[model samples]
Target: MGESPHAVTSLPTARQAGCPFDPPAELIEARRHGPISGFTHPGGKPGWLITGYDLVRSVLADPRFSSRKELMNVVDFELPPAPPGEFLLMDEPQHGRYRKPLVGKFTARRMRLLTERIEQITTDCLDAMEQAGPPADLVTAFAKPVPAIIICELLGVPYEERGSFQAQIETFLNGETGEEELMAAYTATQQYLAHLVAAKRAHPTDDLLSDLTNSDLTAEELQGIALILLSAGFDTTANTLALGTFALLQNPTQLAALRADPALTDRAVEELLRYLSVAKSFMRTALEDVELGGRTIEAGTTVVLSYNTANRDPERFTDPHVLDLRRQDGGHLAFGHGVHQCLGQQLARIELRVALPALLNRFPTLRLAVPAAEVDLRPEIADIHGVKSLPVAWDA
Candidate 1:
């Protein structure tokens, strides 16, 4: 409980009860202690946690820091290299080899071109919700499907298999399932993708994964890429939609501002991303001893980049806790930073820009069906924090 800047403790700190939107109180306090603080990884290894905006961003951009899984010093045992084509965890040429080929595929213009299609998808979801009537679990009914369908379709996941695919992904990524279940789901997903990649190689389609099959990427590499896209493509955006709506509903003034002017849609999405920061934290290991935040991170030391706290840094944003949809300050680390920044960011932006406003417009009376405190939240241990089932209702 000491406020010393060098405080070290086990992470991740729990979010206070009834305060789901804020970072864990301990994390915020740790940020107050200093941008960076000594910590112990869950495996009992010495580590550091980065919570300040500038420090987090700088570390993300620093090449001396390694994103490689094999290099992480969090555990005594050596971790295997990330599966083939899992570029996010690799450094340099290996990362570039996988990432560069796909950069042009998700360009701003390409994502922008998908707006009409995204709008159509959003409208379809609203139509389904309207048909189903009020008091629905928005996670299952709306949030999950919007991104699920888009990503599934984009990845060329067979229509007949999407339900299973979605369920498997939810099982593994939600972080609630047991270790055995998680590994089973993960193995199943990898097996399925391997088959899908082979199928695409023989019978290619217009989707992104199918397109990648034509390149020199091996089947294993293609499968890894598919896993990355499918997981990242849906999980983050789905949670953002559900959690952002919760934040807006909680702050009626911000809700009113967004509903009153559709032009605020873009800013609202960005602001919500900054405020909620559902992806929480990521780990990076130092390749060599490096000075950061006035502390020396020794070689192989893994640091937790606390995105939720960094996005809420007081020095970075005025009134950091307030959810101002019109917030002008723009350099938030919600989608991360540097070479490892989210590749699907443009697509996510377009989806949020379309989905949130449409949902608000469709149900003008939208509000939490149960008391906000009763809403079930995914555990802090979940890779992405969000509501488990947001039971929302409007005028019947």
Candidate 2:
């Protein structure tokens, strides 16, 4: 009922050594103390960190917590409004306007229709990995390319342009690139998307972007939407594939269960989603004073919703830290919740369902090539969490 004794002074960057899948120790400790803890943003603004499953889900669904970029009061300076069609950072009518048109396009049934193509994509990546032999960096050979190609095809990006597009995306999302390099990659991507939007307008094709060309959305808006889809479509799933593979190898019992019963693939994917939670945390600003977890979140204060910890909350899931492929609990926030929940989640699910099993089945002896500690992980600063390179090897 009273304020938590713990106060998070800054965002944690490093995960505990050898515990790559766990949220930062400080965050887990904060959750242990209580669901909501006092937090001081890096920029000196006071805030709260919501680490409980129920509280995080509540904040996500509550309209009183604003998602608008400009409304976030954690930083000292005013933030620019979200670019057009980036509905993740917007709210209400505007978010609905951009999202409603695409809702039907990404439903579970619609994404399932793409299962055949996704299988082929997964198969192709595995074939390439086989030809190249073991000790391959799965991040490049399999994880990154599988989703990269699928998203490219979905957006109607030509095969010739995909390599460059993927490189630019890597630069911006890698989380370790210099500021200048990051901005350059961002600008190049925007320019390319702008050009792609124009091409789609002039010569409509059988792709999601081209389909949107018929809508009332402007080219700029279309470009913004394309950027969102491309980035979200590729990065999150790629990380899940690589990181999930790593988790399975470490938990042979779970891996063997999945391998023995192919029907368990869907459940395994859900368990991995809850375990890894690579998307990590998200920020929301309070539109007004709101009571949460026995504390008041003052108006204009920003709060960090810790998804990783919430997904692993003890009160929510039994043996929360263990990786249990057969675990029956569902409704993880891996893809998030509420109005701004991931648009491409079903597509992501399809890709994971097809790709992960295909990779495991293709290489029955698959395991890490390097020491588990040597596996390079993306820094916490990245919007998405994942591996930089998953070095893997299997018996030849």
Name the weakest run of 10 consecutive residues (lDDT summed) in model 2. 1-10
TM-score of each: 0.98, 0.98
For model 2, name the residue pairs that clash.
Answer: none
Most accurate candidate by TM-score: 2
Off by over 4 Å in 2: 1-3
**85-160, model 1: which lDDT tens digit per residue?**
9998899989999998899989999999988889998999999998999989999999999999999998888889
TM-score of 1: 0.98
Using alpha carbons, what is the TM-score of model 2? 0.98
lDDT of 2 by residue, 39-158 (tens): 988898889999999999999999999999999887799999999988888989899999999999999999999999999988988898999998899989999999999999999999
